[model samples]
Target: MTLSAQTKVGPAGLISDLQSLGLRLEDNEVGVTGRRGGAGPSDHKAVSLAGRTVMIPIATVSACESPFVASRPDANGISEIRRNGVVVSHIEFPRQPRFYDLQTTEGIPYSQIATLHSSDVLATTLLQSCIRYGNRNTSCQFCAIGQSLSAGKTILRKTPEQLAEVAKAAVELDNVKHMVMTTGTPNLTDRGAALLCESAEAVKAVVDLPIQGQCEPPDDDIWFERMKAAGIASLGMHLEAITPEVRARIMPGKAGVVLERYMDAFDAAVAVFGRGQVSTYILAGLGDTPDVILSVSEQLITKGVYPFVVPFVPITGTPLENHPAPTPAFMAQILPQLGAMLKKANLLSHDMKAGCAKCGACSALASYEV
Candidate 1:
């Protein structure tokens, strides 16, 4: 059923639609600058709607054919969002960060080291290369982690000093609230913990912003303590797909680690990061039924871990580029139930110190929490 101009949709519904179907810009002026083809919420632009910012997909194939469209921004930097030629809402795009103009003393651009995520979060991939990404049999089918590296949009490795430099400038210039550092799986041993710790420590040395470090479970649980001591305020270990079959089918090599290992790791990391501070990302449109997603989410909440469920976006240049994203109706079924559960557990996205769940831009789950 197509929505007509008379249909009434709230902020949560609008966010869900924009994320799933994406927004087609009627004019190029609306999105003069935005992220494209990189790690951590690629091909998205931060759109401020209903007093909160969201990372809406704008570069996907689905966006080109979406029912939602945005007109050029007025002098006040606000644009009108229309559905079937009916004005539904007005939105604002975050201006390009001030830090993007500066470079390290060595001449490496700060934008190349760390980019602004959501509206105020500074995000960077410590290592652009991933072990699984190099092999088709092992890589996550939905990943485009290598595209930015290949396109020269980002550097392969960001040194601790360089990260600290960019992080400080972002805080001072852009008023960046926190930092999110995610790395591709470097190896099976530390699983990128060592680099995250080093980067966090360096960033903390020069800035006071909170930091979230995301990676696979490290072989030794002691790394959690090391990370906390290094000034990491929160942690994220993503379970992009919940079911074993889907995990194996979508990310075969990652599946080898097994769900048991992830559970154990989550318990240990939660012990270090504290309740509500340790979180996991669950992608909703990746063949997991609502029951399966809710069941896993309940388990995570029981263990005091926040389960952030987001719609699956088919990034271009990846194996699943042609895969269809979840419909707004599909997300509607899950988000409300999950939001109620989080309320019952006293877990809220706003209370989070830093990270994707805290940013709450890639998913509309945050809006439902209210």
Candidate 2:
């Protein structure tokens, strides 16, 4: 049983509670286009609960429906979210982005280059192709990078020129606050940092939005400095799983990078980006115990890197699509401890200038800290 605590049921808390529980929606295609790539499902849609917008998993593979949370439209462009059988709150879906309508002179849709995430952040995969995505032996078993590109939902490589045009339109038309550019690992030694740096340069020339570039650690540490010089305000080097065994099991190809190397890279990145600006993705419940997650998070905190611990929702079409998300009680047991650690270290997500740690829709850790 969850050891119930007397917690305040405010807006952020309610959104946090719902995202932790997952949300079942009457329609998944209404709001932002859910971008699923090498990351975990990424199938959640944005909802306005109590004035704040959050990304709640509504199109998960394992959870076709959530027991505690569900939403349906009411009259007057409003939505009612029900708990069990009672309506607990009213939520709103953001209107479709205006940038989605326009296209470049080359006839490429603006949205095909990048799209709005949550309510304000702009995000895209600079290179949708990855070296490790071809087969199970090298592939991170959960990656769907090839799925959308294979179906032609997005293009292969978004040139710097195309990205700049899209970024400018997204900012002027949609009021985008920040930009996040993540790329699949290419065969080159620079991984995708070279592409991210070029993309960041292009976007910064066109708009003044803070940008975050996500990639595996580059072959050398200097790439961090080059990336910062290119106008990327923050960096994300993800370690989707915590334990060595879980790393090998869920993502053999990614497991080759090894935790020791990631730690060294984190040290290098923090030195360049300073504290809180360097972050990593730690997908909770891909088989890591709560103890393991908290322990690793502590280590990451010590290095000045933010541990963006998010629940692992099994994406449809991936190998682990049948796997279960962490129990709400598990997240409850962990968030408080992680929150205390972050507070003590002064590594709050808001200190981050740009990217997922600041936007913070996929995870509820930011709300937990408050």
Candidate 3:
């Protein structure tokens, strides 16, 4: 028997393959569309590639429909394009965590605080609320943090003990491998980094999984060292956009964090976490040109930071929900250049040791480029 073709392909090819799998991609101002249940014109669903389900609005899909996709989209945009009724390059959807079945002693849902990502990684918004989430003048246009919270799916503040309990259960029952603690910016001296450390320490005391913490650069560079000491194996200080104008328009609140400050934090994190352990997320197709992304990625690689570039897929209820994902052709065009930068700097995703992009689940850029 011959194995199904595993050659890498681009976005257009990915969509075509998915269409052949009985999945349809309906172009909408709200991104790609598909159908899950008994089909009809009104049955088309809006969905996210994150976990690959026909995530129709709550009003559309029956509550009985699986909330998560049985198979997810590959980094190149291919779905289950099977041959001879056998799956190829199958992408597994994250299994819902057992922790979701429990609640904090305070009666808060565990899922509300920190939920599982990629089946084995625990991710949470320590503070579900961001100062930016409410202010159109300040919020990252693409963020749905507040929308999810308002929908009663998550909590605003998660206690350290609560995080510890969930972490313990997730690791023991679900085979969780790592933890990611992120937060909305609080009007405090340490920004959200200090709270992340407290949560990291709490989770560390009970579980031994590698931990990654994401936050803006704090006012003090010393906080990076503090985080490393707190059992965090790696750090993510995201510079979501590369250009000043885009920064201001996309994330007014985060844009206040000067580029120099981020560079400083990246340098500090590298010193503490070692090369390849420090990373930043660069979202392509957010009105940024390939030239700009390549230039910024080159600089990040030179500084010993892994630049994890991903296509910007706008989520529903966010300001950019209507925005289209970057064409796969665009991603393919730039990934080679960005990947070369990684090779030159010796910053490979496998070298990240542990983290989101390192897992190579979100973007196929790593699998293809590396």
Candidate with the greatest lDDT versus the true structure: 1
Judge candidate 3 at residue 142 and give its lDDT. Answer: 73
- Consecutive 10-residue window with the lowest summed lDDT within model 2: 1-10
Candidate lDDT scores, in order, read 0.90, 0.81, 0.66
lDDT for position 369 in model 2: 75
The Cα error of candidate 3 at residue 56, in Å, is 14
**Candidate 2 steric clashes:** 0
Q: Candidate 1 — which pairs collide?
A: none
Question: What is residue 38's positional error in candidate 2, in angstroms?
Answer: 7.0
Ranking by lDDT: 1, 2, 3
Model 1 per-residue lDDT tens digits across residues 1-370: 1122223767788888889999889987644555777778977888888778888888888888899898998898788888889899888877888999999888888888999988899999999989999898999998888898888888999999999889888989999998899999999999999999999999999889899999998999999999999999999999999899999999998888888999999999999999999999999899999999999999999999999999999898898888999999999889989999999999998889999999999998988887
Error of 1 at 17 (Å): 1.2
Off by more than 4 A, model 2: 1-13, 26-41, 68-71
Off by over 4 Å in 1: 1-7, 29-31
Q: Score candidate 3 by lDDT.
A: 0.66
